[model samples]
Target: MPAGPLRGTIRVPGDKSISHRAVMLGALAIGETRVTGLLEGEDVMATAAAMRQMGAGAAKHADGWRIHGVGVGGLLQPAMALEMGNSGTSTRLLMGLLASHAITAAFTGDASLSRRPMGRVIEPLSRIGASFTPSPGGTLPLMMTGAPVPVPIEYRLPVASAQVKSAVLLAGLNTAGITTVIEPVATRDHSERMLRGFGAELEVEELDGERIIRVRGEADLTPQTIEVPGDPSSAAFFIVAATLIEGSDLTIENVGLNPTRAGLIDVLRQMGASIEELNAREVGGEPVADLRVRHAALSCIAVDPALAPSMIDEFPVLFVAAALAQGRTVTRGLDELRVKESDRLAVMAAALTAAGARVEETADGLIIDGTGGEPLRGTANARVKTHLDHRIAMSLAIAGLASQAGVEIDDTRPIDTSFPGFIPLIEGLRHSS
Candidate 1:
């Protein structure tokens, strides 16, 4: 059965990265901070809850959300463990924030998050005097005691990870000196951008293709109003959906076009996607734009490894797009995908294969043989295993739109973590079509 093309303009939820930072930074500012267009997803809510647990007054308002800060070095020890839910951003960044505050904090998460490693942050933060007693393999369900007298250090990221970088920076907030992070490959700079917006003395320099970010310690952050732009990662599903379904024409509004997070658009265009940027503007220190996308004949191309950091979160859906394109698509330098909410590379390979696509899982990436614009022969009983990963659940849902039998997902609950209204949004677009 063929599905109709998608139409209508849709605004995705606020950028998850920005939303998480807003809550975290707002709680650290000296006064009240008001935020509009904050994502009310579960992950962000978990951050809000954790802030409240640490003595910040975070509450929902009629227009948006509000946070009363605890100021620098003023966080209270939580009465119990911080329940981080499924947000790795919340857990890792909070670990950094707590690392130098002289507070003992215990952090725990759901089963999926507990399985993911926290060693990357634990190791770097421990060097700054933070001590952790983590579950084996440096996984979650751990306790961290902040350094009474924190010492700053210049650290180079072994892996390109925004969470790791942000963790180190956040930990440096109350340390005695400047903390610097040198990235071999630039990751998302939401923490840096938002930190500066909150009045932290931070500097960024590019030397020999590496980004050096430094933040001064014991800086006071001033509260300000923030209006988070729409999340481009969430918009990606519809972008690929419209590009794959013939006769489709759609527009996504208020999407953050931050250079660090817009690699998907570039990569999709490289694969022959028809996407236009309209009414470009700036929002909350990030670029914002409306995107007009249409159906196009796609050709698979070998993706550059350097593009991984910018589009890391969008790979699952990108893989879905590749499965319907012409020729073969090869992706490399994506070992990071294996440690996400799920083993995205292996899960996507299994899911797409179950849906009748030829996908070969690689050690670090995937090789996909495209169907040359043909619909997948999805069986009614072919349930895609979501493994509690929101991206995987949503990506497979989009694949269902172009499947003859309409794909079924093992779980849609995880979608609430990022895009709570995803199914309703898809249904509305389908009805409009």
Candidate 2:
């Protein structure tokens, strides 16, 4: 932990979720799409590379990224396998983008992504006439054959997953009729928002508390200028860092405050954190704000199940916060954490326990008994296994800030997939103080 309070106004990289969509949708549109504040991380860069391989002119410019697209249904067969490079978002969503294009494409990823299940996206896409030959256990390194004249169908999401939902919706873009997805639980709406922004005819209806999203097929998308907001997920580590470190005061600027993705803020506030949303505004169809977070004494609270979809990616760091707060923090309805880049639920529990915090791992979530604001007894010799998950690597690094002996991480390479500048940013903040 630093000897003094951290004080600074910093902006993280652009929103990863939105940046992925921007690149994918930009590649599918009929004309040029200009994206400002695009995240140049490895994951998003993978999407750009795939787009270029399939006939899109995705190139960098002085301002941002400029993408000249191959219209819907116009994708060319790639010469080699599309290397996804640890991005599950890129793999799943790209599978959907190619699902109706009458092309044969093979997708592959690094070890972490190769271990994740692709069946969620594969099953729904197959229902819409796409054929796939995935690895055993339905993992990646899969070959896909798209249906030239595809038929659209209504899909009801069994789980709340934005990537799965986006895959189905993107597959429907070039089909023959209207394709509808009924989400039993809401996930991030970045795909839907970006789809509509690109001139695709899409409709959203909420009935009986379920969202029914419909998109017309054979639709042509018009390109536009987009400015992506800062990622809330990347900001989570800083928010927890400032909250736990005594006397710290920091401001995170231009963070995407999309209600669907801002659940971490709500949960932290519920735990007695001092977070103020300043300069509330909208950018590129999403809510944006500057968050002023100050160190405060926090108490534990039961996190609601419904909040899972919104804060799913933030849970790892939230677990760290729980380990430092007073009393116990209980979380449930997070089985989805088990399927991320690593088994986040189990890995987080194990890592926190090694740091001298009491954590009980459940089937769905974790039960953490906090140390009541005391410094964690982690040692420099105690290394946390990140399993190549970006969130896990970054979350544990933030934990090291307040640990007694400073935590050691097994690998930080995974951080390049999302927040490439995370370590530098943290070092700058500490050095400034």
Candidate 3:
């Protein structure tokens, strides 16, 4: 089973971040908003279901989908707990949505999501008249009481989390006055963009070095038809796989090149991976274009700490690529990885080392001494542990394509979250062999 060139025009799934926000803001807006090309992954789908639990009626239409909004400040109390399956995005953002309303809601998720700490969000949102009865350690299975005319406060994020920022902002929508949140490190701005798109009075200001986002209460939203661009994150695995596979040439179409999320592309190019941008254009305020990635001799480069937020979800795959490159790649400011779907940084370091890649793990990030563009000589039989993470599983599978010994992922089920067509898409690329 040799790695093959992936040559085709692949339309990746809808942007996960944008898709999550679209469904959520649509549910909060009044009238009908038709959303085409929504990410139907488990995470985004969980958001759709969460919206319905909160008095939002969203139904599928002929060509697009329609959501009858509950209007800002008009959400009814849900009768039962909101069950978010395997989606941290759905759970965290919904907590914020649940916070500002005068409703009591409980939220729960799968075991993987339950372990993630909710205290970061709970601490800030609780100030705005909301109260929570979270499991010990502020983990999930959270019972929330949304504040009526919630108090708007200035919150400083302990860490750089787009989810926490969006949560506070969403809760701010129901607050009586402006709610301000400051982040020293900027995360993805999808929620902020989509909020304004829905006609909310949101103001973003930079002070000192942080992004201070203030939103005026009680939004009057206009219906919108969002054309979601292809997901760049989902495209990352294929790009790395194709580039690592000798004689490979692949073109990924219509990928969202949001400045906040294109770090993976930049890093790949810096590592001497041949990636080109084509048909550059803007869609719904985000720059999008086709990506052409080709096989090339590779060398690793030390990553800038600033790029972490943009490519946070891509570190695992990037690690795989770095292991196959010519020089050492050092990464820093990645403390955020400790609490993701799995302990990504540590877990990936262990897995890469297990498969004959030299990796040094740190509290915040990793330093990988590469194999100098050599295919990893994996152990006699190594089953890469995915730890129930989609990205990790996909990355290991891609490694199999290029490693001396093909890789096996523990479970590939989670790949459906973003890239439902992953295996088949890669298999189809066999023609390029």
Candidate 4:
């Protein structure tokens, strides 16, 4: 993984979360919705395909992806099961889309995704009058029948899950009344923000330390032209890589800096990473910025548990950053990581350990002893297992670049689930250097 300092300006793919919601919402709108800068990742593509299968017109043009939606409550029952490759986000959010429509659909996915718990979405969606027949473990390969006469109810999230919250709110869109989601802990607000952008009557208010998000039912969604900002989660890999490798000064352009999704930047800055926001501005109703990250001496700090939701997807890479910091890094309140495409906490712990990082796996989080800014010894002759997780693959790839011996990953194909051109992007930086 030895290399000279990384130097370049790059724009990662569009935000996956926002892209997924855009496709879903566009498919449910009344007219043609155009989306530029849409993420073409496998996960987001799955949502598009599912929407197409349910009588929506989804096509990619030279400019961007375009969607001709079936109006609200106009979804057709799919003739075949919806195949969600490795995207839990797609599966969960699409489940919500199906909940209030008068459509019956079956959801299937890859082995990693099939193992993930869908019960979180299932319980609340069922309360909104959707009928679900989940597998034995409450995982995928599930069958769902959307409510013929949906009911609107207020649901309080038992855990901090944006997916679950999104599912309930989406179901409310086709029901007769308001669907309320009470979040004791906030997750990403992309769903709420995009819902409002599409003309859904949604409002958010905070009361007594909890967030109350309500969406009016039977929404008349208007078509929109959306420009998805660059994915901060995707850009996180380069940010960490640049910070860990000496002499690196890299700038990532048009990155989404949504407060709920920008916690990684805050934590990294607190750990003494030199990340500067240049040309901070707004794009598509979300905060956007170009980030200039330079190599810096890093000191590990205890990660606050409360910040997990905002940067949940970036923790694998953050673990890699922590593994190379000056001291031990402790993280907790990440049990949610256990239910992602893979067991991220365990997989990252084992992968880094194989590459010579001192790591202790905990029930909820990990304890990583950094190399004190030195290159990892790498796996020597062994390969790190990705477990079909995109973040695990990319995070270890970054680790490899800072390793004495290049890290070998068992599979990097999973990267296409989110960051499609990751290898090419890294190679471009290497060649440019």
Q: Which ten residues in a row have the lowest lDDT in candidate 2?
A: 1-10
Per-residue lDDT of model 4, residues 65-167, tens digit only = 8999998888888999999999999999888988888788999999999899999899998888889998899988999999888889999999999999998
Q: Pairs clashing in candidate 4?
A: 1-406
Give me the overall lDDT of model 4: 0.93
| Clash count per candidate | 0, 1, 1, 1
Candidate 3 at 130: error in angstroms?
Answer: 0.6
> After superposition on all CA atoms, what RMSD does each candidate show versus the true structure?
0.8, 0.9, 1.4, 0.9
The CA lDDT at 130 in model 3 is 90
Task: State the lDDT of candidate 3 residue by residue for 30-132, as single tens digits.
Answer: 8888888888888888889878988887777889778888888888888888888789989888889888898999999889889999998899888988999
Q: Which pairs of residues have clashing backbones in candidate 3?
A: 400-407
CA shift at 86, candidate 1, in angstroms?
0.8
Evaluated against the true structure, the overall lDDT of model 2 is 0.92
Q: Spell out the clash pairs found in candidate 1.
A: none
Superposed model 1: Cα runs more than 4 Å off = none
Error of 4 at 26 (Å): 0.8
lDDT of each: 0.94, 0.92, 0.86, 0.93
Between prediction 3 and prediction 4, the one with superior TM-score is: 4
TM-score of each: 0.99, 0.99, 0.97, 0.99
Q: Over the stretch 1-433, how does candidate 1's per-residue lDDT look in tens digits?
A: 7579998888999999999999999999999999999999999999999999999988998988999998989899899999999999999999999999999989999999999999999999999999999999998899999999999999999999999999999999999889999999999999999999999999999999999999999989999899999999999999999999989999999999999999999999999999999999987789999999999988999999999999999999999999999999999999999999999999999999998898999999999999999998875865778899999989998888988998899889999999989999999999888
How much lDDT does candidate 3 score?
Answer: 0.86
